[model samples]
Target chain A: MPATLRDVAERAQVSIRTVSNVMRGYTHVSDRTRTRVLAAVEELDYRPNPAARTLRTGRTGMLALIVPEIDVPYFSALARDVIAAAAELDFRVMIDQTGHDHERERELLTGDDREMLFDGVLFSPLVTQAELLEMNPSTRIPLVLLGEHDFDDRFDHVAIDNVRAAHDAVRHLLERGRTRIAAIGAQPQEQYATPQQRTAGYELALREAGIEPNPGHTRSAAHYSRADGYAAATELLRLDPRPDAILCFSDLLAMGAMRAVFDAGLTVPDDVAIVGIDDIEEGHYSRPTLTSVSLDTAFIAEHAVARIAARIEEPDLPPEQIVAPHALHVRESSGG
Target chain B: MPATLRDVAERAQVSIRTVSNVMRGYTHVSDRTRTRVLAAVEELDYRPNPAARTLRTGRTGMLALIVPEIDVPYFSALARDVIAAAAELDFRVMIDQTGHDHERERELLTGDDREMLFDGVLFSPLVTQAELLEMNPSTRIPLVLLGEHDFDDRFDHVAIDNVRAAHDAVRHLLERGRTRIAAIGAQPQEQYATPQQRTAGYELALREAGIEPNPGHTRSAAHYSRADGYAAATELLRLDPRPDAILCFSDLLAMGAMRAVFDAGLTVPDDVAIVGIDDIEEGHYSRPTLTSVSLDTAFIAEHAVARIAARIEEPDLPPEQIVAPHALHVRESSGG
Candidate 1:
């Protein structure tokens, strides 16, 4: 049988409470007593049972990362960074994918399934801010929102400045000597979604460039996917004056747009320049090599982890909203 | 406060034990009593505390999926399928990335960290089967092996038949009238690894086609990544009789190989045919598209979950080895 806390306490010639304090990293323990407890712990190989520790302290050292989807490149990359960052803080992450379903997101928020297993949650909600607000007060675990969400004031949020990043991508395209620029992956019905934020940025950049924003140039997709981008781009290509350049909401969309451009017998950059957001790894090896507005995923992950940890440490602490930095990577597809 | 089990029993007008039996899905309970307890549970919103139940039953209703890396496309895709399968079985999944580190894999195998949190583990070990055997007896939780591992006799395993799948991929390449076929992503140092098994299949197909297997045409990568594949392909292109066709161990490598071919001013299929294993999503959108050996990920996920559940249900049951089906998806890259 494995050694228990009592065995370590007995071996150290200390009380069980004293040993517990040392094991829990309590500063109240004397240095000599701490050293004795540590030595005994090593000698007896007394590793505390995580479940028992969780029961005592109400901290499981586990975080749940609830995202819309895991198979998508962006989410998978973000998850990787989150896991790495959590590991640095000595925490393990449990991943939950909602498949961008509102009901699933609601279930995750309201159900008792994850509350008892994970100490805290890092959620990238697909549900609207209003829905989130309605459910906020009942949340039993500390949560940090990620990606595009308008819950900054109510919850700790870590994300890139989507509007500004999208504006930068459009500005980059405008400066590339392309005037007939089109935007893909717009979700007109959703006011606070990523596509909406990016479209706003696209219009702002066009207006700033003295180019009148054309509603016809803005194409909406049901979701940010390659197939959606391809279909949107195909429609854009059918316009009387085809777009000279296209700025996409995501790398996946951009890749699809590029493919559509090729299928329509056009070359990237020379015929129709392309730029995208989310510098997913596949972009590097893509035919023309994707140029993108790159989110500092590692930076976002670090801050998200730190924020969640702080919230767990101080449950009543005021929520903090952080916008992580992003960069526009000019590559072959963008004529850089 | 949330309703307790005692409160639920009182509301149902049944004994606490009877309520517990109903909640645990025990079949011995009368239908009338079960209905009463369920009604009370719904009215009181008496969601059982998972941790408390775990403590009592020694089942956490959680599974740990320990992979070499979560960010890699193949692993992420597999994880998605696994998560979906686990969800159907009313189990949550905790992801653990070992980063293909032997020490990390060893730690996961020996340490008590996951034992208390997860009921079972689905480990895709980076370590050798010999190392796995050394650590197997000490693992506290039920475990099922995934991906490339030689632990079939001693543990439940779910994977594609790597050798046969690889042979089929090569056979497809040969029948396409390509004579100078090369193989990439061979890890010669690891005798029983996936790359080695695939390479053996590549050789088998070459011999069956009455073509002399050229050792000079076989290139080895330190790891399976686009960059590694690009470097290996660059070397392969320098051979006296450069290969006309390349079969890569992974889609990522094949994507890289395609990039290298373009860089060398060659066109896919017309100049160099490319095929890969693991038909990741990017392959569908990649320029020229990719032809690949596609493992039925959903099938693998289903069997792995079933096997693990069986193992958890009957601890002493003999380990079962299952080889999931795979298909060759012939796309634009292979001249199909």
Candidate 2:
């Protein structure tokens, strides 16, 4: 059973009016009281009826887009497309970056930001507790989940097949007669979904080809950034038997690995070859054009916007999971 | 002499209470009525007292950072740094992109958005008229103008020295003894300040070096994008006495120019050298690394956030115009 506002106020040790004011995005409430009420909302899993709320207070025609990092090329490109898509629906978007903060993610997902000023939320979270997302669920706040989250079908989700994307990258290297391949971007310590899925695909491809994956060849990156990629590849190149080719989880990491290859006085496709995902624009202009699996961010943005807008109008709509397409382009780096 | 709420109400033919409610961000106001009231506010040049508004209704701890395009590396980097800087001051930032639209720029600069929710705005508009910003001066909304704009001492402005930055880029090419140095990114049609200032600096560098600036050597680009750069360079390479070197206004342009040079069966520096501004991270990892002028975005972001926060405290403080530093980074593209 969902908790009522009175129960939330009791759990927060505040009056019902105080809890209501906090939820309404009023600035009169102190930050401490707001925090307490949000915590209770998270703990008790309180959900306000979307239809009732819409009838009581008119919709703002504003949607909030929350991502982990705005500077990352993938997220920035996705954001531009999402803004354009929402604009077509007569909705304006407000963008915010959590900078991969877990607590901040909790605050925005379950706190006043849910329905305060925005009609719905299009979120690409890195460290979200999926349960907190169900504090209101799919019918609660007109939310759409984006990127790699293990979807439980309680909310609308938009994603790419990360595992298959990784498998295709590794399989392409094998087809090129490159046997000793390595992988970059395995984050085993975190609960992140993208890296784990990519790792599984990489190993699965190698096993199917009758090659036992060497534990030493797989590297973990704390972040899918060029610096991290460079550091990981630098270590990989120093191994007794170096990797002949590498499959990076992201293009930024591939760029770093490419630099590492050049700095070590090796020529691409001769001494080393590389492939990355999310075919960012930088890859096309890089010295040797990068071979990457292009995730259709435009499709993801369009559908995510469409789904959120639909959910706002019909809160009883069943949750959806839309998988965007991905394709690999052969470039100089992979000896295409 | 500023217009009052009553004047705006009279112009829109709406009640004073309705205008007042719109100013307070009430959602009960219909979209059509909201649009009419906002248009009247823009026409009448209504100025609301930000200090009084904060007193009447508690201040929202929100700041807005507006830019031309978030997908552009320069702006995205700036947004990331601005968000970090604002967080340090216990403030949260919401970002929006204009996509270089003139109408949207006018709306955000002088509309109900001014004091509806955000405590202040950090705007980097592409096509803003210098006057609508005066609808309510810097004090009226604690605004900090960023990037290339002609400042008239009516706002707190943070900018890079574009002319000097351009001059440094061109001078580097000349120092390499490349006399036939054609340039790209001259916009003769628009009132945009960056390209115009860059053109001035490029001509000044050639004159100082005792060379006649040939009319054929100047190429205008519709936008500082890779596609535009590639097309412009393709044309420059077809000249009778083709340019032995190129000066691109931006790093993305240089990347495209480099590709054009390669596609024309030539090599960088040994054939046609190139220099670009905005030392983006992509430049560092490109095949033959690009030479560029690095704008200090961190300094701009830090100073802009500090200025806005200070103005929110003392709204009557004197406006400031800060010029962030720039430096030339010589890399492989310029025969470094």
Candidate 3:
């Protein structure tokens, strides 16, 4: 059998309570007793049970990271960074995927299913802020939102400036002498979501260039996936006066759009210069390579972890909003 | 404060033990008492703290899934399936990425960091069976192995027949009127690893076809990554009598190899045909869609979860090995 607290106490010739105090890192114990208890712990390999510790302190040293989908490249990459960052804070992360469903997000926030296992949550919700607000009042757990939608300072948030990033991508295409630019992956009706913010930037850039934003140029996919992007791009290619360039909300969409262009017997840049956000690794090795707006996931992850840790420690602290930096990577797809 | 067990008991006019028994789904209580306690639990919103319950019952309803890296397409897709399967069993999953390092795998197996938090572990180790056996004696926790390696019945395992799958891939290439096929992603020294098994299958198919496997036709990547595959394929292309076809260990590698072929001004399935294992989603959208050996991840995940759940329930049960199904998906990359 593995060594227990009693064994450590017996080995140290001290009370079990004293051993527990030392193990918990409480400074009340004298330095000599602490040293002896540490030695005994090392000798017996008596690891403290996290469940018992959680019962006493109400801290599980664990966090739940809720994403829309794990198979999605962006979310998978983000999860990798979050897990690494959480490890630095000595916390384990439990991943939960909601499939971008509003009801599932609500369950994660309000249901008792996972509440007892995690001390805090880092959520990237697909639902609107209003929907989140409906559940916010009942959320007893500490949560930090990651991504575009914010709950009006109701929770801490970390994300790239999607609007600005999109504006830059469109502006890059404009500077390249490509005027008839189409925007793909637009979710115009979903306020404050990724598509809305990015499409707004696309329009903002077009207006600045004195080009009227044609409703026909903005195409929305059924969802943010390569398959959806392929379908959307295929539809766009069938339109009269084909777009000279395409700006996508995500790298996956751009990739799919590029495939559609190829399938249509057209060359990228020569037929449709394409750019996308979230420069996932697959983009680097794509046939023509991909030009993308790269969000610094490491920076976002560090800030999110620090913010969630702070929120957990001080539950009443005022919410802080952080916007991570993004860079436009001009590559072959964008005719760079 | 959230409602507690005592509050539910008081509201229902029952003993706290009775409330606990009902919450635990113990059937000794009368149906009428069970109904009353459940109603009170619902009315008071009483959530039994999992930590407190774990302290008494030693079950966390949680599992640890340790993979080499979550960012990799295969692992990420596998993780998604695993999480879904575990959720159906009323368990949450904690993800741990070892970065495919032996030391990290050892730490995950023997380190106390997560030992106290999970009821069972589903580990896909990067280390060899010998290295794993070194740590097996110290692992008191229930463990199920995932992927190519087996621990000599020390634990349960679920995987596809890597050898048969690879043999079929090579045989498919040969039947396509393409000889002089080169294999990528060989890890010869790492016995029983996916690369080793797959390479063996490639050789087996070649031998069955009355062809001697040329040592020069086999190439090894430093790792199973797109970049490594690109580098390896680039080197292979420079050989005198360059390979007519290439087989890669993973879809990512094949994608990268395809990019290298394109960069060399070669047309896929014309200058060279390529096939990869692991039918990740990106393969569908590639310029020439990828042909691959598609492992049934859903089937593997279901079996792995069920096996782990059984192991957790009966730790001393004999180890069981299961081989899930796989299929060869012939697409444009292989001229199908």
Return the top candidate by lDDT. Answer: 3
lDDT of 3 by residue, B1-336 (tens): 677778998999998767765664545679999999999988986656887566556678999999988999999999999999999998889998988677777877876535768888998877777777776443347778888744577657898889999999999999998888899998746654788888889999999998899999888876789998898899889988989999999998998899999998988989999999999999998978999999988988889999999977866678888988999999999998
Models ranked on TM-score: 3, 1, 2
* lDDT accuracy of residue B128 in candidate 1: 71
Q: Report the poorest 10 consecutive residues by lDDT, candidate 1 chain A.
A: A19-28
CAPRI rating of model 2: incorrect
lDDT of 2 by residue, B1-336 (tens): 567778899999998766755654555679999999989988997644332233234465668888888898998899888988987896767677788777777777655323445678898866544554545442245788898757668778899888888888888888899999899999866678788888888988999999888989999987788888899999999998889999999898999999999989999988899999889988887878889999998999999999999987776677899999999999998888
Query: What total of clashing residue pairs does each candidate reach?
Result: 0, 0, 0
Which clashing pairs does model 2 show?
A: none
What shift in Å separates residue B27 of candidate 1 from its native position after superposition? 42
The number of the candidate with the highest DockQ is 3
Candidate 3 residues lying further than 4 Å off, grouped into runs, are A1-48, A188-192, B1-3, B6-48, B188-192
Residue-level lDDT tens digits of model 3 in A11-46: 999987677556544455799999999999888866
Give per-residue lDDT, candidate 3, residue A311. 78
List the candidate numbers ranked by lDDT, top first. 3, 1, 2
lDDT (Cα, 0-100) at B75 in candidate 2: 86
Shift of residue B56 alpha carbon in model 1, Å: 0.4
